[model samples]
Target: MSLPLTRLLRKLLHVAAKPMRHAQGKDGYVIHAYRGYGSHSEAFLMGRIFRQPGSRSQLAPGAGRDLMDVGRRMLRWGKSGVEVEVALGDNRTTAITDRDGYFSVHLPLDEPLEHQGQWHTARITACPPKQPPVEGEAQVYLPPISTRLGVISDIDDTVMYTGVANKLKMLYRLFIESAERRTAFPGVAALYQALHEGDDGQQQRPLLYVSRGPWSIYEMLEVFFQHNRIPVGPILFLREWGLTLQRPLPRRSEDHKQALIEKMLGLYDEMQFLLIGDSGQHDPEVYAEVVRRYPGRICAIYIRQIGDSDSRKAELDRLGEELAALGCVMLLSTDSLDMAHHAHANGYIDAASVEMVRAEIEHQLADEPA
Candidate 1:
């Protein structure tokens, strides 16, 4: 089957598989696992348990759940003790699920997970009573020794213009628009691609994308990234919440973003990171605090300026001064071209890639409807 047709068939299967899920409530279910990453001594992985009724054939999206029969169970599913097991090459660990059915495990490897063009497989098993156990696999990522810097990026307005600050528009863009139609900032992909290929333009740097978004949209974001030609890495997202019918509106996570960044910093402690976010949210404050805590760990901070940040120029200036005192430079701009120029000038990318970034921006603008 062709690629598009294959994807369509998978979606159809998911729809067919929904009836079973609708019937199962939250019993033994498929595990929607994501890739994890870490040093040789330690590793991390995460995924959600989805109880959907269906045969194995029905759940076959690239990240689909395992096959399981959804039999009659209690009408209401309450949050309680649920355990899952994970196994790496030479390590295995178990963790319990939270209220929203999200589980994370940190594996301690006796030795380093050496660099190879291979994905470390994580075998995950979920057992809930009466129903058979469902199993799935997730991959882990680790950069090469030649990595020059690490890239930690935000997902919303920084890369794609989701208007997260505006609730209505955020939903419209997120749910209404197709991934192709969703607006990605011009040259952002090019800039990320250039950074992924470090100063030598051939080395693979560790590029981690952190999001305030929930895990429910993981597959959608994967599709968006694939469509936009952005590099795929371990997607670390905030916990899933607000899913209960009683509370339709979920609460946003507190300080998890900075906390996740700090965890990654521990992995690549000695390396410098290019922290990319937008001034539209608390990113400036969060990143500034990061520089203060891990002084010299951040080579530069690029905060995208949304429409008319001029009204808060003094605030931005104060932030710049504080970050400077901690030995971190920051740039507040509206375009990735400026970041490309800075990256090139600061030895983050080859001079030739800077032009690649500029060309991408011009091409993107030219393709846009005026």
Candidate 2:
């Protein structure tokens, strides 16, 4: 569907769902705390306050259950203008939810956190009008000072087998399928694990995943990552697809991804980054822009080939050359093993870990439907 038509349909649906959203009882207000990230001196966390229909419950895997879960998630109404307090250790900060019911807390620490390279818990509380105060805990990852490289990845076709190039198929796979039924690319988990471990096989580098997906599907993606054994990062930078008159459709994918990458670069100024994405979308162009803007901060760029046409391949070849001149190597490959080999050659990952990635590839292939 065209952009305008999609926006119109969404507006219609929003209007239709207004009554259902208001029917959410007073007991349904809840705070959803997302995973956050920070350095020793500062922390950044975000979450949402929503009026949902019912409490979360576990359900058996089936098509009916999956569709129902998707429906419930989509129907959540964000409660805007609410104040949210987040406390980490002895430091505390508060942020008010915007019109979209999203809140972000940025806390500057008086005393630096320990350089343990692990996740810390933050307590979050929100008191919606006429409802009881809701409390939740969020996990914040603080990378060790010994960290060498940072990995920023695209989620759709880069890590998993979501047919993003095709809209109809992508929606079917996204909403109709259960998390257990979704598939990750072969060896992606092992490759990411090796990257997280770094060259010494013990270094604690940051692995950040970015997606153009909506925040409503955050829990589903988390479940998908856990099921595939992919290393979880501090946060999955996702977008909000709010249906408003000023902007009905989400931001352009390239803009969304580039802004997030720039944010990560700004946050980790001391750390060089590895950009992992697919050629199925505008990832190559977006990463190239990042390399051009911040030359030395990017160590390497890996573009997974997903149904690239000859024209797209030609465009990527040009981008690769441009990035190479800027001191960053861009590799366009068909499989994770190739990217693993490149990483090993560049001393980004341990040599022995290359074999581990290969073994994982073979194992994943064996489990696939032939």
- Point out the worst 10-residue segment of candidate 2 by lDDT: 18-27
Off by over 4 Å in 1: 1-28, 55-80, 111-115, 163-182, 240-254
Please tell me which predicted candidate would have the highest lDDT against the true structure.
2
Per-residue error (Å), model 1, residue 70: 15
Question: Could you tell me the lDDT of residue 197 within candidate 2?
Answer: 89
Alpha-carbon runs more than 4 Å astray in model 2? 1-28, 52-76, 114-117, 130-132, 163-182
The digit string of per-residue lDDT tens for model 1 on 279-326 reads 878888899988888877889999998874565777988989988877
lDDT of 1 at 72: 24
lDDT of 2 by residue, 1-370 (tens): 9765555444334433433333342237777778999888789999888877662445554443444444665777788989898988878999999897899999886765544547898899997877678888889998887776899999988988883345455444444443334468888888999999888877778899888878765765765688778899878988778888888899888999999889888888889999999988889989999988997999999999988889888988988888877889999998999999999999999888899999988876776555
Tell me the lDDT of candidate 1: 0.72
Q: What range of 10 consecutive residues in model 1 has the weakest lDDT sum?
A: 66-75
TM-score of every prediction relative to native? 0.80, 0.83
